[model samples]
Target: MQNFESLNLFAPLEKALRELNYQTPTPIQAKAIPPAIEGMDILGCASTGTGKTAAFAIPILDFLGNEKPRTRAYHPTVLILAPTRELVIQIADSFGDYGKHMKFRQTLVYGGIRQDSQVKSLKHGTDVLIATPGRLMDLMEQGKVKFDDIQIFVLDEADRMLDMGFLPALRKIVAKLPEDRQSMFFSATLSPTIRELAATFLFNPISVTVPSKALTADGVKQSVRYVQRDEKVNALHSYLSSDKVDRTIVFTRTKHGANNLVKKLERQGIVALAIHGNKSQGARQRALDAFRDNKIKTLVATDVAARGIDIEGVTHVVNFDMPVEPESYVHRVGRTGRAGAKGIAISYCTSAETKELKAIEKLIGFDLRVENPKFKFGESAPAAKGGKSASGKSQGSRRKNKSYKPHWQMKGRNKRRSKTASA
Candidate 1:
């Protein structure tokens, strides 16, 4: 167990850690902070809530201390690239908390909104710049920005960098950065591309792994339920109605499904909200705000909208529709069990979705605790009750649907290549 005082972090960082009641270093933080301060590039593998942000942020802030004079445009001495706008905002907020007492200024630039505010912030000369690939590249091409002066480059969510189809963008952005600068990358999963990036960017960097190989948060208790496709809603309704549920996030397959689930839950007297790509950013923010503030007991979201939601006290995550891609299951359940709190992830699987369940199990390298809820209408056989059946034989097996909407999916097709060039 490493303590904050022994780490020899700068006063402001140590003070913030103390204020945040961080007396002991998490496994990742314990291994990450020291070497990073010594000007070594780092490759850290850790889950979402295992204090990864602090592990990198504290070290980067210390490295970027108030030595350089302020510039007119936010020159971004420390560059942190994130996959999504929500993640960019969250990282910037964490930076603000730890770097407040220091004389450092940080700015967050991402898509999903107008660029006026971001451009204005850039003109004011920020010391640290946290941004997404698309928006940052756009700003650069518009002749409003450049990464020529960045001394430190941090790539957060390396798995997502490849997952969200941002590998090319990341390569382009990294190409523009000074090759001599320090480089670091953090992610829950280390794909081959990530390893290749480490070789291409870092110089003999110490590799750090916390609770090493675990894809999802250790604090999250994962389980699954076998149900018919039509009965997924029924199972979810039952789970929410139980006295055990406090706060929950329900993930659906599509935007329409998310909204429909919310409406279904609301009709059953369960207070719920939905967030998706089709909704206006204001509406999405409002729903997130309500969920975070405890005004909404449950939030249903599509995969895209679920990426950047950093809410605490999320008691459980319900996968109403299973994700075909195995990695997505890890990210979906990661919403809970954050900030060191225990949480639960319950996935609903149908007969047709069995392959996906098996794929997820293979990816995680563990079998989920499977539960078959005893339904109230258990004995009604379609053929026994005179209802027409395709197979005609009436047994305990109930028919189910096979197809689901994975409007988008992770293309984890081939192994990431080594010896990366300017793609």
Candidate 2:
């Protein structure tokens, strides 16, 4: 409970943890690892940056490393199913790092690339297999993969799998696995839908929830700017130019929005790359590698593409477009302020998005600070007559007759007005 050493992990695993500089167990790890080591099915509710991967990965490695090797041809001892290709790769890397001193063979398979390499790896035997649901199903249908030898089955990001319409595939995959095996379900948020799905797979699972005071990471400082719809790009440019923003991830609502934002940033002499579902796996990986290696300062992405991205030294997260789902905001800002490092989350909100912002605030149970000086608290347009601010307080009470004059709008107002009139 106090440290990883106290968990009685195998010597090799302990050594690997020390090599990875994992001195203390995170809250989720501290609670979930013990039960997981006991061979009990685990239901964990933890977000991306909370070290949940290690909570599950360490116990599995410790158990498999000590167990006798099964004489199986195409079957793996452990199977981890994730939603995104990025997550599948990330989880595979964690297993490799944790099992370095052991003789655990692991292979990861996902879509968006040739399967010849993955098939060749599967032709040999492996102790661990990590894969995305779609490719896993494809390989299974071809009889190239087997779960007969599986001792443990892990469903990582269960909610994401459902969100991406993998529920049917997941059910089909789970039906093939031996019901006698231990199951582990880990996700950021466990809704009723996820719970029902878990019930079908896990047996008397030990539930663990690492509660946060706020949905966002503790190290992230959150703020918002009241900018007009058209002026968001300028505001983002201004913020990124600051010295405080070393490396940042800018979240947009749509894939096109992400690409367009990158273009706009490039025109202004700011270098950035965009990642979305449409990008090939190689392209997405290249952009992520550039950002991680510090070759690029900013990476533009949509909510779906940004999932499972774990990079260090990310100083800021810019929400170019507020997400309709409040839970997504938590995941967006979570890209930064990771691994106990301090980071900042800034949201650009326009008048049209006030309702979405309010919904996010209500979900998070706090008011985001309005940090833009040009827009006074009561100076902006009246919030829809009966609407409320993100704080759940009445908007009419905060409305004022005074008009706001943004600095950017003042300079080109007449020229823009003339151009519009001429058109």
Candidate 3:
């Protein structure tokens, strides 16, 4: 459909869309919304930043806004289960924006904060509940939450929940919900495991898949740089200092690594922050708020922590550490290039990570353009053959025997030589 008006959404939701200046339905939104509004179970496969939040949110709001009052005390009519606290908050906020003109009530509950407020909100009851799996289960067991009144259930980021080993919890959550409810499952990629879970939960679901050239968003420009492991920080520093990088997210593999990188960047006079599993919810929210407000130029995060983040205007995404799972590369780069805005994804791959890079290429069905320190953009790196570079050097040999050094380190060495000569 060309516009929100064409979708026949509730007038209030249409008004909200007009106020927000939403002109067109994304591919996923276009296909998913129609079936969803018809009260059909929907299984949607679309990447992040494709307006997936609104794809499901808009229809759910419309359904609730028009339907008669079925809401019961301490029981929500609609339940949304996401994988992360950040995403739970994002989804709740989206509902709030779309349902502003309606009187339907919604509240988000997640871990890492005192549950007193959430408990109080639950005691009074709400029309909708957005929550992470763990917190939702905790409340369910304590009798503070119930799914008997739910008419609609949504599982957002199903692949991510599976990756985080929440399948068991999901099974428990699904078991608790009434079998006679509309179901919706959304994920960036659909693996066999995800399909199996969908089958177990959804009944005769209408499937919607928006296929792309690659798993990531079309607006993102992806590239990789082969550098020594120790030089990644320096490469990131250089990239952040460039004018092209405005509002960036640097993904690391570990919480400690993210914190350390933030410290190193701060030492260099860069205003950066880190948000990971280790940070308190308040701190993570603070960092996210600062990033959204443009008060911070860089936000370092781990893959799990970054999953639910939906900040806009991020021009660059730096993979300070390559993800072990190839699918994660798609998610990492997705942080940028959202909503038709151009985005750049730069990955720092060390010789040790050739295998990881190859796995990513195999999954994405294309080789990423390789850029060395001396070259802004170069030809695609030849695929590693049998854990060896195309040049017939073993991965270990490339890491240990290659004599090439980073330009910045060489420059420092040259400065030392000049100082000795002058002395």
For each candidate, the alpha-carbon lDDT, in order, equals 0.78, 0.85, 0.83
lDDT of 1 at 3: 84
Where in model 3 is the C-alpha error above 4 Å? 212-219, 373-423
TM-score of 2: 0.86
- Give the Cα-based TM-score of candidate 1 against the true structure: 0.83
lDDT of 1 by residue, 1-423 (tens): 368789777788778878878798888888988888787889998767677898889888776663554555846688899877777878988988987777887888877789999888888887788998989989988977777788788988887777778888888888889888888888777777788877876788889986533537678889988775556676688899998998999998889988888877787788898988678667877888898898988999887678756888999999998886777898788888876689999998765566788888998888898775563322222355544443333333333323432213312221121112101
- Taking all chains together, each candidate's TM-score versus the true structure is 0.83, 0.86, 0.85
**Which wins on lDDT, candidate 1 or candidate 3?**
3
lDDT winner among the candidates?
2
What would the per-residue lDDT of candidate 2 be over residues 193-213, giving only the tens digit for each residue? Answer: 989988999999999997644
Span of ten consecutive residues with least summed lDDT in model 3: 375-384
Candidate 3 per-residue lDDT, tens place, 63-130, comes to: 98788566666798889999888998888888888889988888789899988899888778788899
lDDT score, candidate 3: 0.83
Candidate 1 Cα errors over 4 Å, as ranges: 72-74, 212-221, 363-365, 373-423
Q: Rank candidates by TM-score, best first.
A: 2, 3, 1
